[model samples]
Target: MVIADLFKKTEITVKNIELGEVETLNELTPEQLQLIEKGLQTVGFELLDDKRKQIVQKIKTIIIEIVQNQSKILQKINPSVYIAESIGRDYKYLTTLFSEVEGTTIEQFFIHQKIEKVKELLVYDEYTLSQIADMMYYSSVQHLSMQFKKITGLTPSHFKELKANKRISINQL
Candidate 1:
């Protein structure tokens, strides 16, 4: 992986890579971190050393993974618990820091990602609205519809009918 290569190139011992994060065996010096950051920036990656930014990015990554990859089992796990476990931090701390850095609450960011996922499903036309509701962990089609309309400024059916669903990327959200 690019990140692993960056670490290896810098002689940083990598202990683990999980949940879209890398754990190093030892603390990196400021110079080493700057070198890695510059290297990553050149390659369209980032090294967020600011604590708040790191937490915010972690929150977004968790939400993106849930929305894009694990939509069917979303309701089984609480967002707060899932993020806390994934980021290895308290949920309140994560929430506060994320809101401060992102200018939106984690829940709002999550909803946006879910809406994007719904748009993708609609564009696919592989599932009915009811099926999408079930898969997306909505209590009912109406709830999903309402949320979808609130976020997209159009009803789900209307959006689907438009034949031009404008889905945003998780990174853009």
Candidate 2:
């Protein structure tokens, strides 16, 4: 009876694996390339060819590191300085590369990520709009609202209301 149960468990595990429910590192050689492909697919973005893709990947790493340290770093760091210092590449080169590969300026990409973070903060409802603006380093709540409306076509209040109704995934941004 125990042997039969063990066999059944093994069969079910095999079925799950066959159905793509199980993931393993062996399935993903060249891990960095796999990650880049997956990230683009997740966000409905397209990958450039290998060389351009690598450049974009580096830019993304810079963005991610900055954002992760946003609270500590943003207060003292201007965007240009942040880009230059963190990326170890001249700001002009990085911006030109980002624009060539992404079809958007680096500033535009940064704004998009900021807007996405604002959306997430608004959805949480933990912070007031003013507090969100302050935390995110906007000059004022009005400034935050203006940018939010410009990018999302909704005011912060309206966004929070809609968020109450239906949530949007930040990754999908």
What would the per-residue lDDT of candidate 2 be over residues 66-159, giving only the tens digit for each residue? Answer: 6545555788888778777865878898788888888998877877788888887877789898888877888999998999999999998998
**In angstroms, how far off is 46's CA in candidate 1?**
1.4
lDDT score at residue 42, model 2, on the 0-100 scale: 58
The 0-to-1 C-alpha lDDT of every candidate, in the order given, reads 0.85, 0.69
Structural RMSD, model 1: 6.1
Where model 1 places Cα greater than 4 Å from the true spot, the runs are 71-73, 85-89, 164-173
lDDT string for model 1 (57-122, tens) is: 778877898888845446677888988997799998888888778788889999998899999999
lDDT of 1: 0.85
What TM-score does each of the candidates earn? 0.81, 0.65
TM-score of candidate 1 relative to the true fold: 0.81
